[model samples]
Target: MNINDFYTTRKNVFDKLQSSNTATKILMSLLMACFTGVMAQVVIPLPWTPVPITAQTFAVLAAGLILGKRYGALSQILYIVIGILFVPWFGEMTGGLDIVLGSTCGYFLGFIIASYFIGSITEKYAGSRKFKRAIAVIGVANFALIYIPGLAGLALWNYLTYGTMLSISSLLFMGLVPFIFGDIVKILGLGAVSKVFLPKE
Candidate 1:
């Protein structure tokens, strides 16, 4: 075929692929999973806890913020799927079911639920001119869904009971306090990054 004919042919194929729902879902899921894998690579070890800080939270936030609720949850679920069935995509290492049985499983699973909530809230506020509302939803969702559950898992693993672990002071020091600053920074960064993906609505 001539060069122009070939170009047109390729364009038509690309457009057709992009228009397919399955193609879109697979593409977005892979993109988010890749981001999760990459984010897990940048680990910041901390002395106080086995759960060291990492950019994986950034990936989690972005997955939710950009993908919205259903797709965001699907992306995280896909990450778990790939990690279990294929390669171990968890931070700084790789393993099978043992990874889930380890100390970090709570945080890992929490990312899925958290991403859905964060994405949902962000979707609502996205169309409003009120950046503050967007910021608030983003902040609350990240803190409540991701951090709270994550740290609670750690606390429970440490043998802290539900009532005690859920206490304000207990959550503050064990979960919220140590990570608040870091979470804030991540939230801000993710918010800025989100603007690139979310349309001007």
Candidate 2:
């Protein structure tokens, strides 16, 4: 019930489906992208920070764990592209190249990286007996990937637009401090959900 076991189990499932279903895979990927957009709408704006608390990160984690690496990453990539070009599916239902080039852009890029990281790790560890714990760990790792870029992006945008360098303490306060507990809840929630839904091989 470690990474090797998980990889083998996933390989078996994929091998079974490899024969006649490229279309289903494509459809599912698109749906995951759409699902992320929908999740973005469930947002609560923070008074102090430009970033809001949204369900999008949970959706991103779910997509990666459920869809596997390639499709999971594709789903997020599609979500980002759609937001940048045509959809108001980002936080606060806002989008366009302006938003993409805005303060939160780092987090958007992080979503893609996080999705790939989560999906890849999940696929690698599919057969682990301690599935729930492993998923929780994976979720935490992915969150770090998301937040690092997010904080950096915020600082970068601020500097470029206003010529003011944000202090490390200020960045942590705006980007990481308020959300610590919430993100912990999300990691645990995803772990519990995975325990119920994923096969423990």
Candidate 3:
């Protein structure tokens, strides 16, 4: 088969995953929550920053792209709520109210907001295959939407924990700089498979 044929086949397969059914959407939210939970387990702690490198970021973005705004946000809500209620699927198999108010909660908020934002933007591309546009939006959502809240949460965590004032540059180096490459990799990977999750009118 030719390249176009391969692309079409792959597109069709993934496109089938998008559904308008309420039941299906509910199932998707649960499935994505589980997926994020599973991905959260792959944590690599950094010495400089408390934020670990987990594939959960990728999973979170994927859930938004695939499930669209409402269900996407719902998925993250389920993930957070269940984790807090004692699912123990959070990073390092830890969960509870402490995690909610902990240093990383901002990213959890980011995940929900980013998912909703991504899903909303992707909806605008319903019938079109605008690869560059999709990538750009994904980049914006991942970098801006996620990192803004994340940095705030991290800084708050540091202040609450250390009682020391830090500079903005210090916050970036600790919370943002280390994760730039990883998020870029995720953006490229998701952009490449844009046909799969990007909406089809």
Candidate 4:
């Protein structure tokens, strides 16, 4: 083949690969970010904190289940990035690092990491028909990941004195107990919902 022709073919191949990667990134980023935003509106507003709880659990769990580990993480990171870009896609239509500085910042960050961890674990157990088991794992992982970081963030943000039971109790009342049952319901509901959406692989 002529050198020019060979060069042209190689360039075309390279362009195709680049296009494919871009398409994959777009599919993973825009689609998943939109899904997460929609889930935020499906809310159950609480009187405790401005950070209303929502079906974000479903979005987080489904991200990992459908997209797997790396893509799932990318999807969540995209959601956060877009939210920070001032789109107000998060809970209560809130956005920016101001939300991050709020009481639920740790949980906000935890959501992304939890999605990755759950996705990684679920991807491994995605053998034959271990779907329920995988969901259970994801649920527990999501709960702990959100709860621990959330509580810590709240306590630290308030600067609760170590020996002050009132501060400790306030933290529990505000952070942990109110949402415990709701979160459990969320875990079970979202886990099952994810199974329906996830491909049987």
Give the top-scoring candidate (TM-score): 3
Q: What ordering of candidates by lDDT runs from best to worst?
A: 3, 2, 4, 1
Writing each residue's lDDT as its tens digit, candidate 3 over 71-133 gives 989999999999999699999899998987888878999999998988887766665235676
Q: Report the C-alpha lDDT of model 2 over 104-163, residue by residue, as the tens digit.
A: 888888888888887777677755314566556555655588998999999999899889
Evaluate model 4: give its TM-score: 0.75
TM-score of 1: 0.76
Q: What ordering of candidates by TM-score runs from best to worst?
A: 3, 2, 1, 4
| All candidates: TM-score | 0.76, 0.86, 0.88, 0.75
What does the lDDT come to for candidate 4?
Answer: 0.70
- In candidate 4 the C-alpha lDDT for residue 28 amounts to 69
Q: What is the lDDT of residue 42 in candidate 2?
A: 87
Candidate 3 collision pairs: 126-201
How big is the positional error of residue 200 in model 2, measured in Å on the Cα after superposition?
Answer: 2.4
Give me the runs in candidate 1 sitting further than 4 Å from their true place.
1-20, 128-130, 160-174
